[model samples]
Target: MSSNTLSAVLEKLIHRLCLNDFPCGYGTWRKTKGSTEGAETEETDALLDLLSCPHSPWRQDGSWSPQTAALRQLAVLTPERLHTDFIYSYFTTLHILDKGVSVVDDGLLKFSKLEELVLSANKISEIPAENLPSTLKILELRDNWLSALNSLTSCPPPRLQYLGLSSNSLGSHDVVCHLTGTHWPQLVCLDLSDCEFQNQQALLDALSTLPCLRTLVLEGNPFTLAPSYPGLTVDSLPRLSYLDASRISPEERCSFSSLSKITDLIEDRASATVSVGRVRGIPDPSMSLDENAPDFPVITYGYFITYEFLSHQTVDLCCSQKVSESKCDAAHVTEDIFSDADLQSNKNLSKHRTSKLTWAECMDFSDTQTYIVSDLGGLKRFFNQGLYLTLEEEKVLSWPAASEDRKGGKEKESPIKSGSTKDKDKKKKSVPDLVQDAPIRRTLGSVHVPLQGLVKRGHKVDVLCDLGTLHTESELEATQSLEKDLGKKIKEDKKKEDKESKQRGGSGTKQKNTAAFKGRGKGNKESETDVHTDNSVSVQLEPLTVELSVELEKWQSAAEANQLTLPHKSKQPDLS
Candidate 1:
């Protein structure tokens, strides 16, 4: 071992201690002169006097030289001193932080009276049970590289009360079995947070044997995301008072009382069913236009709902492993193909490199015209934080009488434009332009429906969300501008078409019979008058209120005979 190692440094310090005598004090053996003559006094009296002295070496000092503190502490103790005396006379806590300790050796066992051993933020991979003292009550090995506890658990400290093994890789189920009450019977607090433990039932069942456990921290574990979570753990272990630093209240205890039954304790998979129902109270866009017009322009509307929700899906480990292997092979092949001598090739290779893998759950939002029924992986997200549903209205205006004219005009212009421009130069217009030309859509309002309370009602419940009669200023302004622009464009197009028609009819009708020509001209004039009257009309619209219903169903894990079946949606209903 290196001389800078913890065991080596401690061993070297112990060798410098005075073993034959109490190095801090002077002793004198004298007979009592009053009653007994020639009687010798014990040497312990001098040792006690030295301990009580203000300048005793055993006394800790804030001003003590850091280089000599270890030597002074060693000098005050002798080999013959009792472990209990050492504990009471000196310190019983040993804190070693950020030390490059790769292994725990027997050198620590020399501190027989140690009650607390904190070896946090070290590189320790193994802690042999023989190296641990029986008197230790608190053992904190946080932020270490420990992957298994077999050796330590083989002979665990009998009186251990608090064990902090957080931020380690002790994720295997077999390793967790050693943490039962059979090993550490007196354990009162245990911290296994940030570990890789994936099976919740196994961990909970193993920890339930602890008779005195009160505080348990299991945060940052994969199983922590399970919907059952703290409730399942609380009910499984009735003696527990605190979970992940939060105190379990009596009401929570009562709610999870059913979980205490062994029959009810089953492993759960992440799955849920969300059903969006009928929407009501959509405003008529035609109401915003003039009511007493001669001829009203045809107005069509399409309504849809947009909502953001948490979608959970479980990924197969085997499939992920295969994918990762294939990706690695592909990367190797690409590296071989691109030579290091070519700087440009290297840069191009870097651009194509795969990004870091992620397993995070993100929010998923969808837009649908009617009711939506989706099967999600879990309802944990909804239970933690609710979702929002937005109501949107789409309005499309069409002039049925002039539809044929517009189609004929587009057909006549298509061939001329196609012959003038090359195929590469002829690009389609962007989406915004198309949207601005015809349809106008805007959000009516959004309602936040909290699913937490609804979940408590039952496994499945219907939720009615009311989007109040409030629309944002931006939405109202955009809709108004779109309507005004569309109306103006329609009137301008109608006027141009009327002028062209009069020019064409003027020469032909004048050359023909006068009576028939006058009748035709009068009919054309009346049609133009009606179109002009419709264009001059306008109306005020009232505030819109929207209400939607949704059905949410949650499925919990079950045993072989009690398997849960998810609600199936065969066909979506048209709520438009």
Candidate 2:
């Protein structure tokens, strides 16, 4: 490593330490094994895929629950993974905690120094504890269905510090704790947390006999809190230094005592919040419905954001291997061709040159300010000029690189220096000046990027210049045409909406059909009555005329009042 490299690394560590843990977002990480296809096997690749999953929106996936997807992606988010070695090595503590690790098989673990055994909180139902590590210090059987402690009748771990029987639907607490005098003599720290430790005195008294007993954690065991028989105070038992009978306080001797392997707290709020709770929308479908789903459609959207990896120029290919991409002439190329992709003109090739390798033609952004380095490594340095990236949270494919040849061509394509031609012409006209010809020693190779509106969502993202595949040309055109069509449709929709609005406005001024419909049966009955008895009807007509006049006046007032509501539609228009 160069001094410059060391300095860069130190600077990055400082920067990272000072930064608030950013939420690993779209492009936080990408798949290590870039198949752009099926199931990922490698953890790094899986990690990358998990990190990158949020960035890509699948057109066919309307049922993708974001929380569930995040959970699946963050399976390796636990602290044990930070040591990576823990996942691969297990010679220290005879271990068998293959709880819920769905994909991992038993063959991977070495189980040499592995002493602790926790098959709790898993799909596992039973196991022979006797055959486990003789050095096993703890046996976590919580959250599983283990009905008997007799399964360990043979030879349990000699130095077993803890035995968790909590949450198992197992009966016979007496038999489970029956090992105090016999089979499991070294059981010191026992966690019957959430277990039916109902036989308190029997269990506690039996447990009290364990000569090495120091810690008893009986969380969620309500029986422990029940009124002590006769008059025993809860704290009267004084053999233990720590007793976790209730919920752990943040100040509770730093969460877990000396017995826990997991960290008490994960301080990275951004990462922690991202993994909180079971992923939503799994085994729950009622969330997608509304009181009235028949009337409207629903939609969801996502955007991908990005940054550099590892805040440095060179990237770690694995745990040790490193690769540095050299940057030259302020440009880079991204090509799909592996062999003969680069087309070097025969004229440009020297006699000694045997073959031309075409990685791909490169393209530079319109006008960007960049240093003219002799190689591509310098370009990567530009990305890390700020902070450590390489976070897989925001998984995004790298921006396209421009080839040296193309960059060279682009460099030539740049506008010529002003006034240089005039100066050269004058020198050419004068013989003395011409004879005094001196090569211009002063040179400039810096490139200034021209300003352009970037992709709105990808503004912070590195722009990958694509020397897209030849077959993709039609796809590109189709995409462009689609965008144009969408724009056109949007404009048309607006116009149609405006026209409808205008028509409504024009019609709103007319009298509303505010007059109530006359009640039917009574009017027909009255007409028949009038025909059947003309003389009789004429006599009653005087009274009817007076009542009808008064009703007419009242109806007119109501019509005026109802008209007020009709214009309300015109006041507020739907923006969507």
Candidate 3:
């Protein structure tokens, strides 16, 4: 529109032409030794002559077509005189094939007489409708990557009668909507073959908007794959005279009843495919698993069908849309007053945010409980501790106790079943050692499983082992607290006993009692004897606490080593 805009457009064209070979030699016309007007006149005449003749010394082999020869001539033509008002009046046709031409410059817009433009096989990603000459009647842009055709509706060629958009990516419905009857009243021939359109019916429905469309090319498309493609195309567009390369006739037209049945079958197949994709519990094909692996246990009567159910519940809570939308700043007030966070704060919550428990929290390695306490809170309470997560694989949950015993590289023989009297006594002593090591061979928590088949099979399940040998960390802490309380009580009792003795006896006897209590308290041997004699609580727990501490340290080390050997967990199957 402006002189600056015209100069910029001309500059880009000059850059493109410089990248390719000049058909008439670059040096012959680039630096013309004459007046600017004379040089302009000389180049304009040469270009028009090249287009008109279609035969030249450069293409003497007759291999180059007339359109191909004209394109090469125009590409090499110097851009120095393109801005001149009357310079474009000489050229009526321009074909620039494979020249990487993306933009049609405003300089080209001056071609008021341009009737044909062939820009096939170029890098143009969009239709340059605004810059196209109004006199353009035939425009071919084959093999271009045009994703939008809406621009043509906004600024179309006033006298455009033929359009070729073959091999482009014009698949969008919005693009079809733009090419309506009102937008291009003079449009007659439209070539959209080998495009990205897949839906046959939708394309035909959109094309019906073009009231003047006579010649419609839809070859090399999904629509043509249909059995009744010829009949359907003709019936859809009653005025389409030439369909692809074939001429349509009245005898080929089919009845409306046949068309109805064909549409119904295609629609039914499409809907069936969509429904199958929505099914759940399907394993991904990319992953490999053992063919002999046991099938998932059927959920007889449990809260969850699989581990996925528990995980999904927690995921839904943590990743809720409301939580994401709510501002993180403390000053922000959420619209939902009764949100999870609000309810938690009102009830003085101190635990983790979500109700779902972590694997570590579910385990309690204490000897106080009769069963290994996996805190499935609501599940345990509602179902009367009926659910027991059985380990499908042994190594997943436990560290082998035999591995710890084998550290010394000494192999122990199995105890004889029917031995002598001496062998019977040795087996009795070794029995306690085996019993103590049994907990290390088993897991601490439940293995979640599916309940689909189990419900129909009527199989009975119960807690296999209580795991009473392992003491929880909480139990150790409580033991330490009790020891402290016992020591304090002993000190208070000793002081009270000395005060009572002073009131009943002489000063000399009272002094002896005070000295005995303080001096005896500091001596380890005397203090131990006093605790056994005077304080029953401390004496009984001291030996047990020492034994438990040693066992806890050994178990912790074994647990860490076994964790390192465990394989990474696989992605769970979707059990929707």
Give the Cα lDDT of each candidate.
0.54, 0.33, 0.45
Per-residue lDDT, model 2, residue 408, is 29
| Superior candidate under lDDT, 1 versus 2 | 1
Judging by TM-score, tell me the better candidate of 1 and 3: 1
**Which window of 10 residues has the lowest lDDT sum in candidate 2?**
544-553
**What are the root-mean-square deviations of the candidates from the true structure over C-alphas?**
21.7, 39.3, 25.8
| 2 or 3, greater by TM-score | 3
lDDT (Cα, 0-100) at 374 in candidate 3:
13
Over 403-518, each residue of candidate 3 has an lDDT whose tens digit, in order, gives 24433544333343348889978865664323122211233233332222211111222222321233333344455765786688677877787778868798887778778766
Return the TM-score for each candidate structure: 0.43, 0.28, 0.36
How well does candidate 2 match the true structure in TM-score terms? Answer: 0.28
Instruction: Tell me the tens digit of each residue's lDDT in model 1 across 1-576.
Output: 776455775554434433334543222332224435333443444544554469877444322113334434333433335243453335467676775777787867767777888888988888898888889999999999999988888888888999999989998977878889898899999999877677778888899898899999987665554445556787788999998888989887776675545434334433333444444444444445556542223455555555543332211112112243345321121112222233322221221111122111211111111112121112333443565666665566444332233443241222213454564244333111111136676776777766654333334334666675543333466557656765676567556656666776875554543455456556656755665456533332333333433333232322211333211112212111
The residue ranges of model 2 lying beyond 4 angstroms of the native Cα positions read 1-109, 171-174, 229-238, 245-576
